[model samples]
Target chain A: MECKLIRPADLDEALAAREQYTHDALPIAGGQSLLVMMRNRLVAPAALIDLEPIEALRGVEVSSAGISIGAMNTCRQLIASPVLGEEVGVLPVAARQVSSTAVRNLGTIGGNVCHNEPGADLPPALLALNARAAVRRRANAREVPLAEFFTGYFETVLEPDEILCRIDIEHPPAGAAGVYLKHAISPEDLAMVGVAAVVVPDGKQTGGVAEVRIGIGGAAPVPLRAARTEAALKGAVLDAETARAAGETAATEVDPPSDPHAGADYRRKMVSVFVRRALLQAARQIEENGHGAA
Target chain B: MALLELKVNGQEVRVEAPDTALLLDVLRERLALTGAKRGCETSHCGCCTVRVDGMAVHSCVVLAVRCEGKAIATVEGCGDGMELDRLQRLFLEHGAVQCGYCGPGMLMAAQALLEQNPAPTLDEVKKGLDGNLCRCTGYTPIFDAILAYGRGE
Candidate 1:
């Protein structure tokens, strides 16, 4: 049981408190998943350093550099933001598919990544978007690519004292189209298989893909980028045949575990199907949005 | 332990509770507001749903201390004495109540939905109430009641 709930007035105060109670206390934002764990006797910290009151780690920032999302920003906030809807619409689409309306109301993106649950909706989207995570401990701040942020299931490269401050994702080219496809057992269930794709056409070469990124979730120990699939799709003609081949390549990249909810083989098959669908949908979005689709 | 102050059902109240004390426990035991039931201590069941700053969240998983200075509303606050809110009246009129265990959470979910969206489509209402679960009524009556309430019927 947490004895003291420390509500720091600012980020500096929060960091100072975190330094003081590095091992004794746990920094809790939203307290959705952490509280559940506490109730189950999975974690019993001496104190809970509440991170909600820190203003610096809240809200969304859009600038020329791209979108810098503060760790405290809730899934609801992400879906409600107009700038995110216009620029990185796939993220909101993925956000909406998280647990439920009530959970989305309180769940934070930073907490989501920190919790690092398998089949989480945001990580795959973040990977496809080529986001960077800004982490801080004391006065030292470092930016880690989203691809390298997660080291294993329920693990990240973050040290105990380090806090994820913000996530930075580059704005896709004006006409770049992105899609997130998730397959879950039910509306409220964690995704059995999730795929995110972002496709940008080359301005110089006719019908050639300038950049293609594919991210998959629930098919491996950690959310992963479909590196082979991206390599196959990159510079290839943005067409149905190329998307199909990329999907096949994506299936080979993942090592899924057999579980009660879904078998490893079934997940691998869904990965190929979803990847193909996501690619086709993204390509269609590019055509509809008229983003250099020659 | 911390002295947490919150506005519940439009009344300002203070309670001494541990930092880890769940909002659901504080509400039911300390505050004596048992409208929010303890169905699944886990968030899977919305039997403990409440409004914190007008957003629907599972009170079971929320820390009572963390709700300080926020407007909290439970099923007890949904009605005034014996006078029912429009949605409550509609729920009865549409036969949405069954075993009645999930009534408070269902009503809270519905109220939160209608407050945000005055005229929600059936699909939208289903989406709004996705977090809540009801074993009885097959959910059709609840949906109909909420839809009827939205139509101002």
Candidate 2:
């Protein structure tokens, strides 16, 4: 059977097309992974709604509240945006490390998130930045916190009739530093363990952190925040011992899967190792810059 | 099948293809521009790399319909069609081609990189070609070729 192609001019029309097709059609953004999946027979859709022609899903907007990133913004565009560079520096850093130059040229943040691949680079960084996904369907709209967006392996909370339009991230706290670490055999491979840490310094105590947010990927069914680990590190002076203990706690929080790339035991160990390294790197960024200047 | 009007190698052309036809297929089979090799229909190998609007993308994963109204440059467009380009000459001088299967894709990728960064460090060259894999030349010669091109050798 031949698959139909629908190109919508605007977001509203895209949403309506999505509503009309529902499960029969899949919206293709960049088509980096979706087309590959179709070729491999992993998925067979009756139609594809091409999201490339919609201008509304294209640029970045900065406001006093935070940054609003368009869903169709390619990884190359994210890496080049000066606004993201100044406001949320870690996003650009993580964006640069996604796949390879060829894939980055066409891959978009919306497709990455909606695809919900376990080892994806963006979710952990976006989660640590406290990002929210703005989803719309016809006349209705809603925003889901990035933390609650992913449901399971290659699954998200997105509905068949809805479209992920934007990702909104609030400004980081003053004097906070963010760092993302990826462990993989090759640069192009999905991370064996991906860790992202955002550290906010406590103004009262030198070398003390008021709060810490840790987002982990490739260690569990979905990219998730290390809540218990974060609670343990809250208001604590960051030292090597504290960082090590936080890594241990973060590793305990995840249920990793075993695959040919990595065994379950190996992935768990890497989770511990990378989380500690990421925190130490983030703290070092604070020490070097004096406050949250990193 | 849909009629696709595309700009390729500095010319406008039209072809009738399936709506979901891959850019690699359209370029190689329909347009007869076989310079972009077909290897690993999956996006892993850069053998199918081509420049769309001056950016290198794995054509195997790109839909031909999506490329309408965009400028697509394949490896066939590398030279003036008579003589080898400077980058191609550098590849030969540096012994970058062994089996010669990955040559065209390498040239397109290197050309895109140089257009963006006229002078690239050795590490930058490696990262620029990370998508491409060459089992024959062990990659050192390819790297040497790109670096030499950057240095105007």
Candidate 3:
């Protein structure tokens, strides 16, 4: 990679360096995936703008509006952070499944989301959280919903001069319980089929399930919200039968591609299987929470 | 290549290599510290793992340029003076060093794991070393070694 090591102290400086350089230059944080791809010669950047020096780009804070996760925040930091954990426990829960502690310590959420890989563990949870990303280009900043961020396979809306600056997640959906489950061949391996489910009940589990939301990943081009499944589960009693039905509904809608990890048919089957697993997981969490509150 | 400055085992220095060159190559070639081996070019194998800024990372996939202004601990930095780190001793006691290609990275990973959780359970031990690939199927012995060390046995 043809390169210059640039450590800009602020967003402006970082943007300035990027504007002066070509698209071949990459904005780097954590370097867990970026450096690996570079070493593998999959990415040859002409320049690398290191993001660690910018202190403002490092933190996990909860405000009245939502939770703001800095771009430089590492996965390990997110997982171990009591502040982020309590503010948005789903993120911490998702972060725990991101490979080993070593990878988590060095891999940043911004990188994972920005890379826009469907198999990544964080994106499904982010999608379920209704997360949005703040992108910066020169003096301008705009927020893009996570669902709209991915344009195609391995592609994102990141402009040449822009960088993913932060992730903003609105307060937890009322009665929302989020769960992410994946089928992996082994530890440290990518998921064969991953599923994330978010259930937003009306209030306490006093009555029946009011509204439930679901997302499925590792079986599509991007993490997907199973509208059919959600429609099937809406207002239904959050019981074994309903949850199982939602899983089966999700399995029918997903169009999986054949990869070395799994065949398309197997992936489709896992969609149903994992959705059932995720829904049951979500239901148990909600039941336990209500029990604890009582 | 880019000129980068960083501390290795506590000393400061500057070096230049292909900006995309991995920290593993920098340590093994540029600085001539052969203690950290390159068993698998991919990060899946912890044979190239190292502690950077007190956290373990796959050096084989981390750019040397990114190592700038960070602290690096390689296998050479272990067993200072005359004594091996507790994890290293445990590996020897349990015969976990078969082929020895993955020894340095395993020890580094284990050291970081045990330091974080002195008394990790058997599951925790397995989880901690999940990044490593022991081709000899020597995982049980390694787990035993780390568990023994973890429990101070």
Candidate 4:
């Protein structure tokens, strides 16, 4: 399939190209996922609307509301940003744990989330942070919560003509800490099971959980929020007993698949282990830092 | 076909190929800069590693047209005539090369790492070179060579 590479100067030009070609034209942010799929003959678009040149879709903007990360920012760039590393440590921490440097240098967070790979590291972290994906269709734009974004394995709610322009991660609560833990066969390999936890300290009660969010990946058809587990941990005190109960609840709630790397049972077990560990670590961070957005 | 201008190895070169053509194919076939080997066309294997804008990337997946107006460095650009670069010399000295197939890509990856961090620790070097897999030499020699080079030995 012979394709024409079109570099759209801005978001308007990109949306125009999308409006013309619709599903026939595919947007290329980092081209990491799309190109691999193209090589496998999974998708052959008539044209590739290159999003790299669109300056509007390539930056990390930190404001009072939260961090608005341009979709085109590579994993390497995300990990290198001190601002992201400090405010939303789970994001940069997750970015650093992605594949090798070669892939990290070219793989964009948007591509990672849009690919919606079950084992990808970014989705769970983004989900834990309660991030919102900014999607644009021509002149209209909307923000979709990351928790509600993934519809299925390798599927998202984004329309064929819409572009995922940026990701907006709300600032962590004044006394919240987050951690992402992925159990993989190798450091560079896809996660067998991934868990991200964000814990907000309760100012009213000492060492009590004010708010807790848990996101799980590779344990289900899609990365999802652990609602039942979060509910179990919300009002509980930050202790081994509460975290253990939350972990067990998460293990029961998830639906893992048996694959060559690991069995469904093993993944379920790991989800519990990692979720417990993540909660403990987040609690430790809260205790050490004593609260304001680490 | 698109007329793409690539600044490869510090030289501006023009190539005419389909927009879908990969940077690896254009570099090896059209430009005849065969230093970046083509192995495991999927991004998993680092045999086709190249530096685009000073960052190591798997060139096989990188679109040729997307590489426009960017500095690309390959193993061919690592050293001058009759002079091996520090990494090349150190790899040779430390027996980091056995079959020599992964040498070019490994060199480019290492070069990018060294340029970024002049004195990377052992774990950092291993992480930097993690993308490039060498089935031979057990990776310890490769580590020794990179560490020795970093020490300016």
Residue B84 alpha-carbon offset, candidate 2, angstroms: 0.4
Candidate 1 lDDT for residue A59: 83
TM-score of chain B for predicted candidate 4: 0.97
What are the Cα lDDT values of the candidates? 0.87, 0.91, 0.80, 0.90
DockQ-based CAPRI category assigned to the predicted complex of candidate 1: medium
What tens-digit string does per-residue lDDT give for candidate 1 at A1-294? 346778888888888887888877888987778888878888788888888888889889999999999999999999998988888888888899999888999999999988888899989998999999999888788999999998888889988777888999888876777788899988677789989888887756544678898888889999999997898777888778887888888999999878899999999999999998998888777666677221
Tens-place lDDT digits, model 3, residues A143-226: 998878877666788888898989998887655677878788874666777777777665644426666666666788777778
Q: CA shift at B67, candidate 3, in angstroms?
A: 3.2
Q: What does candidate 4's lDDT look like per residue over B82-131, in tens digits?
A: 89977899999999999988889999899899999988899999999878
Q: After superposition, how far is residue A278 of candidate 3 from its true place, in Å?
A: 1.1
Which pairs clash (backbone N, Cα, C closer than 3 Å) in model 1? Answer: A207-A294
Candidate 4, residues A1-294, lDDT tens digits: the string is: 588788788899999999999989888878887898989899888999999889888989999888999999999999999999888888888998898999999999999999998889999999999999999999799999998899998999988889999999888878889899989988898899989998999877666888899889999999999999998787789788888888899999899999999999999999999999999999988888787453
Clashing pairs in 3: none
Task: Tell me the lDDT of candidate 1.
Answer: 0.87
On a 0 to 100 scale, what is the lDDT of residue A73 in model 3?
Answer: 91
| lDDT, candidate 2, B1-153, per-residue tens | 999999999899989999889999999999999999999889988999999999999999999988888899998887788888899989999999999888888888888999999889999999999889898999999999999999998
1 or 2, greater by lDDT: 2
Write model 2 residue lDDT over A52-114, tens digit each, in one string: 999888899999898999999999999999988887888888888899999999999999999
Candidate DockQ values, in order, are 0.80, 0.92, 0.64, 0.82
Model 1, runs deviating above 4 Å = A204-207, A292-294
Q: Which candidate leads in lDDT?
A: 2
Residue pairs whose backbone atoms clash in candidate 4:
none
Clashes of 2: 2
Model 1, C-alpha of B121: deviation from truth (Å): 0.5
